[model samples]
Target: MTKETKKYNKWIVILSITIPLVVAILFGVKIDAELPVFLPPIYASINALTSIVLIASFWAIKNKKVKLHENLMKTAIIFSVVFLVLYVAYHMTSNSTKFGGEGNLRIVYFIILISHIILSIAVIPFVLITYVRAITNNIELHKKIAKFTFPLWLYVAISGVVVYLMISPYY
Candidate 1:
């Protein structure tokens, strides 16, 4: 990594830990003010958008559209950050909606939800490192990590929407 990219190493570690920790901490914090609008569906939509952008980015790179790929990747990251902000804001303002499905569907919901949560937290560093590699013009390493990062991030994004849909009725 270049000196400039090396600087991001500490930030990547800091953000990888701090983002999830802050989200978990904030999840328990409730404010008395009522939100003007519901946020779950909105954030879920953002997740869906992120997934789409991620897929597009993959396609862009495959088609040799390097600049398009880069731009789309950045857009995906922005969507994820926006989703995180909205998710935290919503959780702080409202109680979580419990999943109400029964039978095998309940099991499926939990399976997806658990995997989604685990991967969402786990994908943070991969994403940061992948982005750093790409932006630093470390193309070979970027491609290597992107192979892993893409799927994890895509699953996290898609599954966030799935979890929301599964529990939306309980809201």
Candidate 2:
């Protein structure tokens, strides 16, 4: 590993550990009595935007627009971080809006939700690793990991929007 990669390794681990723990803690705390009631839609929209950015980044790379691809990917990462912050904040202030759909739809929603949650967690390390590789100029390894990271990240983004849409009515 390059020195640059070593420098980022601590941050990757810190973020990977902190994000889920903070989110979980915040998710259980409700201060709806004090906060405004407008964050869910906003954060959900961020998720949709993140998904779009991810697709655009993919197209950029496929067309050999390396600079555009890099910029878009960085933007997508920022969007993801924004989404997480808003999501955590919203959950901290408001109760979780449970899905009210019954039967097949409920099953489908749960499947999507479960997978999204798992992959969202998994993607953190993948993203950090891929990013570190790229920054360190380890192009081969970056490309290899990014192949897996892209789809997982995209699924997490899209499924976040899906989950929001499904549960919005209850909010």
**Which candidate number has the best lDDT?**
1
Candidate 1 lDDT for residue 141: 94
Highest-TM-score candidate: 1
Clashes of each: 0, 0
List where candidate 2 sits over 4 angstroms from the true fold: none
- Model 2 per-residue lDDT tens digits across residues 1-171: 667677799889998888888888878887756555599889889999999999999999999998999999899999999998888877776677789999999999999999999999989999998988887879999999999999999999999999989988877
lDDT of each: 0.93, 0.89
- For model 1 the local lDDT of residue 17 reads 94
- Every model's TM-score: 0.97, 0.93
Which 10 residues in a row give candidate 2 its minimum summed lDDT? 28-37
Q: Please give the TM-score that candidate 1 achieves against the real structure.
A: 0.97
